[model samples]
Target: MAPPVSESPPVETLDLWLLEAAMELPTPLHMLVEPNPHIALNMADDPRLSREELCERLSLLAERGLIRVHALPDGLQELFSPEEISSAIDARQSRTPFGYSLTDAGGAIWEHHARPDWSRFVNAGQEPSADEAQDAWVIEAASLEAADAEFHFHESLGDVHQPVGESKHGEVLTPWQVTYWKTLPHGYRLRYVTVPRPADPARSRSVPSRPPWYTRVWL
Candidate 1:
């Protein structure tokens, strides 16, 4: 049997940020399908909502303040039992989960965190790419020397990297990291690796370009 799902940590901000500007969605179906159980659903997993329909509904949601736009990293976003969510909310390097209510604020953020640009949430605090990361290198994998003299690789998840991949045992690699290891000059020690990134598009010093006539600058 699969292990239980873990919950997400709570976010503190609660402004009425529009879903559309956050992450694109079609409709605003804020009603919880399973309130007592408080299960989260994503039609993206369902086949009934055609691509067009899905887009329509997601778009609608985005247009309203019912949701927030956030992007999921390569390895994140899964159901967590109330207990797991509870735990995360209880402890964090930063904020904590308020409660199970999915406060109008939390729900609103969760739904639209994907709006303006679905990548926002997923990329939060994401290290600048290697080049951008400067020395920013999200750990792709880590390992401990095995008893049998084999290298044990532990993929990073929110460790050296945010939303880093889960470990071989399928647990978050939050604080645990690869401390010591042996590798050949050409042979990598871990199963995976992350290279530096180019740069942050948001801060790139690109040359200014003329805006279309429709856009005007006060200056």
Candidate 2:
């Protein structure tokens, strides 16, 4: 007989964009006090995600208290913007009426965490501003060389094994350094440029075409 199925491990990461929307409510605070559809419409902009996926995220956000939800009531459409009210009206037709609004804790989290981290994930391939450059730390290249001693590359996987966004060469940053990097302003993505090999390839520290040690980070 086949072995019984093991339970899945607990999820450690939430959807980053979903979390961002929950924390940043574009509309007025008063409208939020009473649940309305305005916030979800504003927050969920990813065309790739279907409305069902967006609803699932909304439910998750509600459970976390980043947003509050309420059952739809008659004539409550007055509270929402034209777009929100229209969506709510359509939802009513399907008997799946619900609304959500950001909570105080959500706003606090936006101010402290999400807003600061927003720049890191969004803007790639641009140079960092002067203020952002100050936040970077220059780590010795030797440490990364040691880390890359066990490096293996699988060309077939393409970007699957690669970092989600731009990365600082073969060496990964320490967790605190990563957090600091996230707090930097937008347009600054960390990546390593390939340094040309010297006349004596044997003396070069960088690996052939795939250098594990990054000499510098282009902010």
Candidate 3:
């Protein structure tokens, strides 16, 4: 028998554009679907929809709990910033298009069922107050080794890199990472951690990105 659909909360609803965006995501990394091809097949170089439409689509996606959107990280932006028009074109061509990712519930719904009014899937989670948000243990790179000791890999939503049975520290840090780290000047090394957001565990918020469960790489 098919498993029953999980109950959805009041907040988990999706409009058509939001549904399309969720479906189009290649992975849970904010993939830029702004010039959504499906919406405008050969429509134009720019978004066929007006700015209001685009903004509304993005807003509805977030408000309905299908995806999380945030400003591009400054460091990452600088790394990708183009030096010239040609460079800009090259960077855009090569870059992993990033923008928004489906929440846990969004993933499940996307995989198991036809597109739904995603807002229907909201979790009846209590909104965390300033105090609770303050108290949440956001891990820092320096503390990764210590934190790994306390939580089993599966216990915490945040442990993105630690894997099972790969090493004493239990992460399958990729082979390239060793050479990459060695090349860096002394006193710096790669740190594996999740992007911190205030957790609204009950409802859909950005779930932490992790390496594939089958093979792990520390980011």
Best by lDDT: 2
Q: Which regions of candidate 2 fall more than 4 Å away from where they truly are?
A: 1-16, 19-47, 71-89, 92-98, 116-219
Query: Candidate 2 lDDT, tens digit per residue, 10-41?
Result: 21133334334334223322232224333433
Q: Residue 23: error of model 2 in Å?
A: 5.8
Report the lDDT tens digits of candidate 3 across residue range 1-219. Answer: 223334454323333324434443322222233346443422212334554444565555455555554322212331111122113222334434334445555544443444333211111111233553222222111133433533333234432222232222222223211111111111111222222355445433334543221111111
Clashes of 1: 47
What are the RMSD figures for all models against the true structure? Answer: 18.6, 16.6, 19.2
Query: Please, what is the whole-model Cα lDDT of each candidate in the order they appear?
Result: 0.27, 0.34, 0.33
lDDT, candidate 3, residue 154?
28
Badly placed stretches (over 4 Å) of model 3 are 1-17, 20-36, 39-48, 71-98, 112-219
| Distance from true location, Cα of 70 in model 3, Å | 2.9
Per residue, candidate 1 scores C-alpha lDDT tens digits across 41-143 of: 3222222333344334433332342332222211133223333333333332333212112223434354433332211111112245445433332222222
TM-scores of the models, in the given order? 0.20, 0.27, 0.27
- lDDT-best of 1 and 2: 2
- Candidate 3: worst 10 consecutive residues by lDDT? 176-185
CA lDDT, candidate 1, residue 31 = 21
Name the better of 1 and 3 by lDDT. Answer: 3
